[model samples]
Target: MDIDLTRTDIIKIVQYAVGGRVSLIGVNLSGLDLSKLKLSSVDFSFACLKNVIFSRANLCHSKFQEVDAENTIFHDATVSE
Candidate 1:
């Protein structure tokens, strides 16, 4: 299952899902404000996260392969070791 989402809507949705588990696979969230959100175990492998703001977002166990992250903000994001 896949859904099309805009930057603003995606941010809002992600914000609500913060501190909880949510799946955002294949969602187009390019250039969105994803900062201050705490996501765990989410699979964003093929999502368009280009220029997306992930500053300070908790991305533990999250996947980001094949995603366009050029110019994206991830100052303090945490990835799997």
Candidate 2:
């Protein structure tokens, strides 16, 4: 199921996430601009990220297993592992 989330909603999720780890399994984040945000250590397995913008965001150690990330932008983003 696709979740309709605004930037504010996403921030709330991140804030309450345990130990900077976000579980985004099977979540659809298509067309959402999550630029310049701190989203490190998020698990994006089985997620749909079509057209999602993650420019300048911190994404180190975030997992993308089986994710659909077509046209997703990671411009100047920090990513590792």
Candidate 3:
């Protein structure tokens, strides 16, 4: 299911993720402003993240395997090996 999520929906999901209430897996977030958002441990596998801004976002331990990250900005975003 390719659901086009709005910015508000993204924020809500992030909020829930912060509280360990939900997980964003395989969600298509193409062309979204995700800057400064804390998204630690979120799963982005096979997700469309083209042109998305993840600058300064806490993405430690997040999964981006097989994701379409074309033109995606991850300036200063944290990631673990």
Candidate 4:
């Protein structure tokens, strides 16, 4: 299923991931800011993250399997396997 989320909604979801994991599978988040957010262990498998800026964001242990991340920026972002 395709899911659409507003910026505010995305922020809320990231906040909710503070103590756990947030699954954003198959969600289209093209051109979103997504900067400076804490998103540890988040699942973004198959999500469309084109042109999304992840500057300074904490994305440790997050999964981006098969995600469409063309032009996505990860400046200063933390990521792990």
State the weakest 10-residue window (summed lDDT) of model 4.
1-10
Query: Each candidate: how many clashes?
Result: 0, 0, 0, 0
Mark the 10 consecutive residues where model 3 has the least summed lDDT.
Answer: 16-25
Off by over 4 Å in 2: 1-3
Worst 10 residues of 2 by lDDT: 1-10
Output the worst ten-in-a-row residue range by lDDT, candidate 1.
1-10
List model 2 lDDT by residue over 38-70, tens digit each.
Answer: 998888899889999999999998999999999
User: Residue 67's C-alpha lDDT in candidate 4?
Assistant: 100
**Cα-based TM-score, every candidate:** 0.72, 0.90, 0.83, 0.88
Q: What are the lDDT scores of the predictions, listed in order?
A: 0.73, 0.88, 0.80, 0.88
Which runs of model 3 end up more than 4 angstroms from their true locations?
A: 1-3, 18-22
TM-score preference between candidates 1 and 2, better one: 2
lDDT of 3: 0.80
In terms of TM-score, which candidate is stronger, 2 or 4? 2
In model 2, the Cα lDDT at residue 10 comes to: 81
Error of 3 at 74 (Å): 0.5
Q: List the residue pairs that clash in candidate 3.
A: none
Go through the candidates in order and give the C-alpha RMSD of each one to the true structure: 4.1, 1.6, 2.5, 2.5
